[model samples]
Target: MSYLFIILLAAVLVYIIFFRKKVVKAAEIAGVNYDELLDVHVPFYRFLELNEKNRFEKRVREFFREVRIEGVGTEVTDVDRVLIAASAVIPIFGFPEWKYKNLTNVILYPDTFDGEFQFEGGNRNILGMVGSGYMNGQMLLSRAALVRGFSSAAGKENTAIHEFVHLLDKSDGATDGVPANLQPPAFAAPWLHLMHVEMRRISAGKSDINPYALTNEAEFFAVAAEYFFEKPRQLQQKHPELYASLSSIFGQDPADGGGR
Candidate 1:
């Protein structure tokens, strides 16, 4: 790698470590109140029962302890951190011992960014991305998309959760779509078969799942997860096999009492 790139990576790593220490200290002293804000803002949080909510809160706290969240050109808020943590926790809520070891930090841009990672000027269609190579162990999210994803009117397309699912898919060493860490060995063939069948339906314009899923196997997994978590009942009714597969993989069945 170029000396300049190595220096930049080192700088990011240093800042993340420092920021995490500060957050942990502040949390211990002040005791962050995730309830009022999470209840007021997050729909998924509200859908959870008292016990599940407690577990969710604990997981969110654990997320803050393990990973750092910082704004790129914007300021990160308590609400922002909670929402981001919720996105991470939602996909893995099924796995009590699960942790985002592949992700050490998240960078929230003010809005959409381009291929060059510029938030202004160039094409900015990308809303969220999992960093790789020199940027591995980090994630980028658009502030606008993050907020909207939690909004009641946002529908099944949750940008933040979608990216986190990609991270989950990557936990097994690749983001090829079959999350070996989460799924059983018997799952690979069945899931791929289901994925292809669904992709064909999407291509024919007959699927309620997003067409973005047709992009690739990885994208399909992420997009399907957004639907699974956002509209569990609907997804369960419409796509029983896919929903069942995801339920087995994630362990939580939001369709039934938040699947605690």
Candidate 2:
């Protein structure tokens, strides 16, 4: 390669090595309170064995170290930090090497935002949103909904996970609901067919999933991912094929008590 290219590559390698050391040190400092917060807010944390818990904690530490979480119109507490990190950690915990490289910032608002992304005005019930175009690599979450999403034991609504899933769905260049690169080649036809079937069921009001999933395929994927993690057993029972597809996509089975 050219001398300039070699120099740039060396610089990148140095940065990666140094950054990892910093991340580990940061994790050491922040991970001590991981269990404490998980005990209070994360129901999924209770099911994991010691090893899994350790792994989850490591991932959480890494996530917090890598991403920047800031609050708007409110103070961002440790509970908020833990919950936000947990939301990100849960979805990709199966893959140890996986990191949300696309997500650089998480902005939490005091409550629901409006169309203009302000705290008040039209309709005012936007829970979470992943940035696109010029605002890419950013996420916005409602503090109230973020807490409620983890506090609730039943519903399959998680603002953090929902937005993170959208982030994952967007990794392949478009958020069309199909994470084409992540799915297996054989999964292509079956996945599309399942989406159609599920949409039909939802339209007929025979499905228990949120009707908002019907908005589009991208939304369907995000909402389905929320259910896949929150109420895995129920989702599996109601939509076995969808569950299986998600299991394959995520490389983990939450229905099996969150095992990879």
- RMSDs, each prediction? 5.2, 5.8
Candidate 1 whole-model C-alpha lDDT, 0 to 1: 0.90
TM-score of 2: 0.86
lDDT of 1 by residue, 1-260 (tens): 99999999999999999887887646642556898878988878888889989999999888887887888889888888989999999998888999899999899999999978899986899999999999999999999999999887788889999999999999999999999998778989989999999999999998999998999999999999999888898999999999999888788788986521
Model 1 regions more than 4 Å off:
1-20, 23-31, 258-260
> Model 2, range 78-141, lDDT digits (tens) per residue?
8988899899988887778987878888989999998677987668988899987777899999
Tell me how far the alpha carbon of residue 187 in candidate 1 is from the true structure, in angstroms, after superposition: 1.0
Question: In model 1, what lDDT does residue 228 have?
Answer: 89
In model 1, residue pairs whose N, Cα or C atoms come closer than 3 Å (at least 3 residues apart or on different chains), thus clashing, are none
Candidate topping TM-score: 1
TM-score of 1: 0.89
**Which ten-residue region of model 2 has the weakest summed lDDT?**
23-32
Task: Please give the RMSD of candidate 2 to the true structure.
Answer: 5.8
